[model samples]
Target: MTSFAPDSIVLNRKLPLWYQVSQSLRASILGRSPQDSLRLPTEEQLAGHYGVSVLTMRQALKELEDEGLITRHRRRGTFIEPSAQRGAPVRLLGSVDAIVAQQSGMTTELLDYGTVAVPSGLAGHFPQHAEVATYHRLRSEEKTGEPTNHARNYVRPDLAERIDPADLIRWPMTKVLRDVVGASISRITDTVEARLADPETARLLQVPLLSPILHYTGVTYDEEGQALDVAVIHYRGDRFSFTVTLDAH
Candidate 1:
């Protein structure tokens, strides 16, 4: 009656049996298997299925519950949290989708995508005024539809004017800029800081006023050493973290 392979290895030398079993279950859940949402089998069922003791199965499930993978209720069974549905992070340099992929059950929706005149302060960042264009987008995540980020991008007007908003829903903005607009991205300069979410941003991102938010500003350049776009993104602090590596040259 069990869906899992009976002969599956339940333990390894490098990890404890409980950890090994928890990892196996985590992988299954992240894979979006139908069993993910269902109440996991009881400890007795799991022990028999994995050919392990009931104590071992309980330890494994406990570890998973602590990691937010499974939720256990009294007189109820363990169920996978919706947040555990997202598989894993897909790295895309300086992109909104990359941020969303870090959390489970999160997706991006492109709202208000279009070209606009470059702002006065921002015009100084570009070489030519005529070359600059602007794109505004609101990114939200979760099946319940909650906003996670609000972003505005300024690109070369010549480049921005060529993109269709509909295409962005299928592909990330960077892909659209590269493949559709044929802009060869070469380098990126990015900076991140903590700031308070304004009222508008709070409402859009579904965060509280004065909530700490991570603000990222990046300038992307083309292969010809031309500035292609400047992107300003704000991410919810509660749900996001940034990591980078450095080398001694």
Candidate 2:
């Protein structure tokens, strides 16, 4: 059994004590200090270490059980379920348009289109102060019409100046970026995280709140390593997974 140390307090500004404790335990199980099957410490021990009541600790553990992160048995105790690892990256032509074109029945729905002042966070990533053209899109596959992805993309004002929002519905942004703006994508930086779908997103995607999903934030650069665009993509967890291969030298 793995025991929680004295400093294992879970921090949550908005949640109740039990939820906070649950989140803390969940993080620990997912990260370091993981305990294998039949190796979890008793609820009393966790309660003491986290300075929470035993009932609170039990509530926390219950949440984990509901999420399938842990399994609890009457006499055998609780155990962590090994998570499924992601797969190798699918190489799209370094272009979203190319990727979409390869998928036979995928369709894009232009959700909202307009120019907006660059957010400070987004501005920080860009080299200079420039109005950013923003596009929000929902992508669905096959005849099911079930949304598989939600994307929010940002482009430099000058590059996107002549872009018609309607054109985006017909042609993917990757083509627009390359053909219309004459920019070639040279590199991309991607960051992935496991997250629960928010309320609005859950409704849009026809999934329950707290449903697991993959969140991706990426920045694409031109041949000169100048940032061309930034995008955030959310993919359905059960329907999609990614793979990346590494070469050992």
Candidate 3:
């Protein structure tokens, strides 16, 4: 049996439990050697390991099954798919550095730029703020020109004032925060969920209505712990595989 380190399987309560579990298991599945066929722990055991309920663990396993990473049989337990693709491209989570590297080579298109009153939906994320600078950007593959991501960025008015539109077209928002806004980003908290595309998002990404999308909400904080930026990004699930690397030690 391959045992995952405790740090490797730790879950963030802020994110959906099932999504975190699924991503952890996906990393393990894809990390397996081609000749290694391993049977995974029972739902109850996995639930215990991750400090989640069995029902939650079951939901996590179902996500893997949906992705064809594992097969579950009554009385026989769950087993990894021997033919699962290895070295698949996946979006690495839990690190800003990794994220910046992953975004390299992608083309960015600025869709909308304005300073507007914070919408009711985002009001809570930016408490005490009535207005913010908002930028809508669409990202695409440089070669294929296929749209991969759409991000709506709400920045603190002061920081937003320093951002150059041309800089956004050239680099990721985090880089802009550090270099242009001079905000010392000390931490970033991100939560991800699977959602169906709304009409506007569907049209923007050129996907069919109700297509499955990966919704990411991220908040970046400065050294003093004040929220500097809130980003709501939608990624085409079909175009990206999300992963979190686990330490074997």
Candidate 4:
């Protein structure tokens, strides 16, 4: 019996064999209780379940491990790792879990809110616009209350009207895009670079003027490739960092 969506390895034979097995295990791992989250099916049982050899199952486990989703114990079983916060030296490239992480609650300081032109050379990026709702937001780390990211977001007016003012201040932009604006995200693109924090940015971010900062500019697009929102984030270099893992494909 299949345990999760996209886990029907028997029916989806054309797909990569090991990957389906991993999704099935991923479902299992994520669903388990905290006490049982540490326990995993033996590699032999998992291999037999999908009619694959232990080597094939091991390969799938390696994929999960490299993603920071699991850890293996010598002479013991593998265990699930806890989730990490999304705000940071934000992942220019996102994983499935990282996308989910973006929706968690975080406090925000609303800087500016109003309508604005779509801007020159960006007409193709918007779904439709001469004017759209624009938001300037500053966020802090959830637990420590330290500054996290300073972001600006622009959404098409028709879609932007659905967003509640309160929700925009509290919810992550990713959630507002999906839940309030009802956009089906096709893909996201962003570039990370280093730059000096200007006076206003330094004051809002609580960093010294002219301090070096890590900056990111990102655009989210719909399935049709029309832009949903364009965002730029500035992260303090001292307080934030990204952990990048290299995976063998």
Candidate 5:
């Protein structure tokens, strides 16, 4: 119970402090070294880190437990839940590689694939010649037999044409980019939003209508910073989570 938390955190008045504390701890657990079994700082240590009392830290830990992020034993310290043992920490640096390089044994199932018009607002994300030479893919994943992400991806026409649609099912997008287009990825930018799944999207993800989900849209750029592709993915809220680390300076 005397161990201090790993980092210092700042809280804003915009949201509940306990929730923010839970989120910070959740990120730490998910971003932990995969080789090590999940363990946590004791409540007293966490209280010291956040400059809060043991009771406040306990309330924050309770939030994580409710989210299936942690479990406590009577004599032993809190441990991360075993069922949620996914290692795919989506770091912004070397993103797709980080996402694909994981021990969770993620397999893809392609649902739909074909050329499509680039959506209107995405003009800046594509070159002028790419009026319609884009492709979209809808696929789901089997992560240890649990359906995890209902992903939708898009590739620039040239990149899309370089590989067979069938290959999309067998390979991760990073592989296709390397073997097919052979372009050096320079940057990735994305936005995450929450929405209620509609009937069709629900059917795709196998979740119920109106269930909460995370929707992501992003653009990838090549070494020259030229936009290479655009992607949209929907993750099953119950099975997937996104974590990002921030700095004050």
Candidate 6:
């Protein structure tokens, strides 16, 4: 059996043991090089390394198998799937920086852009302007070519004027606001909900109509508490996951 460092994965009693183990295993599998073993250590070895029960370790392995990252065999052993794709689920931990950090190396495609009267539903997000610049965008994994999210962004008129369409295609909206428009972002408020995809969203994301999706609405604000931009992203439910961290204070 291949040997593994016992201290490689540190467990947080506060979180689910199986989840922690699975995440660590996933990272290891995804980070492996060609020279690394294609097969994983036995469940008993992994359980001993992580100081978890065999049942908990099996649960962790099951999670990877469900993600198509690994396959288990009764006669042989557990091996990483050859067709596994890059960019495992997007993990969000209650911060804009964290979100941006996770999106590194992804490719962006700007589908459409135009200026129009701000929708009444988004009026509160841009109270000072009746009209705003809008963009329709889709981002996907560069390696696997799998669609991750479909997003529509509305920018304040002033900031939007300073932004270049090229920049929107090259960088994240928040990055464009900060680097191109020179807007100071003080905070970001994200509200997430579960909803079924509409026809347009289903078409763009390549999913069946009415398929469950994660609806994310994020409002970016300046130090003065004025909203500068609003982003609505429809994430494929199976392709993305959010990890939320909370403190009791």
Question: Which residue pairs in candidate 6 collide?
Answer: none
**Native RMSD of candidate 2 (Å):** 16.6
Worst 10 residues of 1 by lDDT: 89-98
User: Compared with the true structure, what per-residue lDDT tens digits does model 3 show for residues 71-126?
Assistant: 99999999877655422345555545445545654679999899999989888767
Model 3 spans with C-alpha error above 4 angstroms: 1-90, 246-249
TM per prediction:
0.60, 0.57, 0.63, 0.62, 0.59, 0.67
For candidate 1, what is the TM-score? 0.60
Candidate 1 per-residue lDDT, tens place, 1-249, comes to 234332244354433566556555555555443443356677788787767788988887887786677799888877767676432322222332232223333455666655566776677777467445556677655444656677787877678678887765655566678778888877677888999999988988888899999888877778887777788988887766665523222
Q: What do the candidate models score in CA lDDT, each in turn?
A: 0.65, 0.67, 0.76, 0.67, 0.64, 0.79
Q: Where does candidate 2 have its weakest 10-residue lDDT segment?
A: 84-93
lDDT of 6 by residue, 20-49 (tens): 777677756654544556778899999988
Give the TM-score comparing model 6 with the true structure, all chains together: 0.67
User: Is 2 or 6 the stronger prediction by TM-score?
Assistant: 6
Q: For model 4, how does the per-residue alpha-carbon lDDT over 1-249 read when each residue is reduced to its tens digit?
A: 222222223424544566656655554454343334355567887787778889989988997787666788989887667552323233332432244344243568888888988876466777457886788888885556767668888877877878776776766677778866777887787777899999878988899999988887778888888877887788888866654433454
Which residue window of length 10 is worst by lDDT in model 5? 87-96
lDDT of 5 by residue, 209-246 (tens): 99998887877788988877776777777765666645
Distance (Å) between predicted and true CA of 202, model 2?
A: 0.9
Candidate 6 segments whose C-alpha is farther than 4 A from its true place: 1-87
Model 5: CA > 4 A from native = 1-96, 102-104, 130-144, 246-249
Residue-pair clashes per candidate: 3, 6, 0, 0, 0, 0
Identify the superior model by lDDT, candidate 5 or candidate 6.
6
Instruction: Let me know the TM-score candidate 4 reaches against the reference structure.
Output: 0.62
Please list all clashing residue pairs in model 5, or write none if there are none.
none
